[model samples]
Target chain A: EPEVTQTPSHQVTQMGQEVILRCVPISNHLYFYWYRQILGQKVEFLVSFYNNEISEKSEIFDDQFSVERPDGSNFTLKIRSTKLEDSAMYFCASSKKTETQYFGPGTRLLVL
Target chain B: AQRVTQPEKLLSVFKGAPVELKCNYSYSGSPELFWYVQYSRQRLQLLLRHISRESIKGFTADLNKGETSFHLKKPFAQEEDSAMYYCAFRSYNTDKLIFGTGTRLQVFP
Candidate 1:
């Protein structure tokens, strides 16, 4: 089966530095999403994208965070300035329909 | 605020024993419910959705409107059933998934 795939399975970056987490959603899927899970915490929604624009976002998705579908296949989350709290497992998900979403293996990002 | 709760951090069961992972949600309107599972060293994958009402891998979950819960249950679990299970919710119109803290199921042989 086709799966959502992310690049840079793990990343370590200094605080205040910019970081870009890339994801290639399942082919033919229309909606894309980003979620994060802190250690020992629940997974939290960050943002969702459709039609080249963000469809919905949570309060946790602040100015520092931005998502882009730079190409037909790539969905990228850019953190302009990373904070220590930004360290977490970031997951990318995609769906052809609204309800059933497929998730990627996730990118473990560490902002030291 | 919308929330999904998985009260148990860990649930231990011997092989062939029944297993149930409790999940509850606080949503005023009806929301779609889902269960995702992640085995050791693997990515998270969908296990069941209350909407489908189909049993996959011998696991089933019922959406109890009265109790505001969607608990996952399996009659007999195998040692291979050990994994981290997460319960999730999404409003009807949007696609963002709100997830619970998750419960780790250890089915011992």
Candidate 2:
């Protein structure tokens, strides 16, 4: 079965530095999403993308966060500046329709 | 606002015993409900969806609009059923999933 794939299984960055988390969703899926989970916390939605544009975003997805589909297969999440709180497991998901999303293994981001 | 609630953090049952993982949701509009499971060292995967109304690995969940719940249940559980299960909700026109804290099911042999 085809599955979503993410690069840099684990990332470490300085508090004020920028970092990009990359994902390649299931090839045929049209909708993509980003979600995060703090250690010991529930998974929280960050943003959703379709047609190369953001469909919806949560309060946590502030100015510091941006998503891009720079290429056909690559969906990337960029954080302009990282903070201690930014450390978490970030997951990328995609679906053919609006339901039944498939998730990647997740990238563990550690902002020092 | 949409929120999913899984009250139980951990549940353990012996092999061949029945299991039930409770899930409740708070959403004004009709929403799609799903159960996702993650085994140790494995990625999250969809176990079942309410719309399908089908059983997967002896598990089934009924969507109760009156109580706003979609609890997952399985009869004659096997030891392989051990994993972390999350109850999720997605509203219309949205691709984002709102997940609950999750329940860790440990099926003892």
DockQ metric for all predictions: 0.91, 0.89
Interface root mean square deviation of every model, in Å?
0.7, 0.8
- Summarize candidate 2's per-residue lDDT along B1-109 as a digit string, tens digits: 5789999999999999999999999998888999999999888999999899989999999999999999999989899999999999988867788999999999999
Evaluated on the second chain alone, the candidates' TM-scores are 0.98, 0.97
Writing each residue's lDDT as its tens digit, candidate 1 over B25-71 gives 99989889999999997888999999999999999999998999999
- TM-score of every candidate relative to the true structure: 0.98, 0.98
Best by TM-score: 1
Give the per-residue Cα lDDT of candidate 1 at A72.
94
Q: Please give, for residues A1-110, the per-residue lDDT of candidate 1 as tens digits.
A: 88899998999999999999999999999999999999889889999999999999999999999999997989999999999999999999999877689999999999
User: What's the CA error at residue B41 for candidate 2, in Å?
Assistant: 1.1
**CA lDDT, every prediction?**
0.95, 0.95
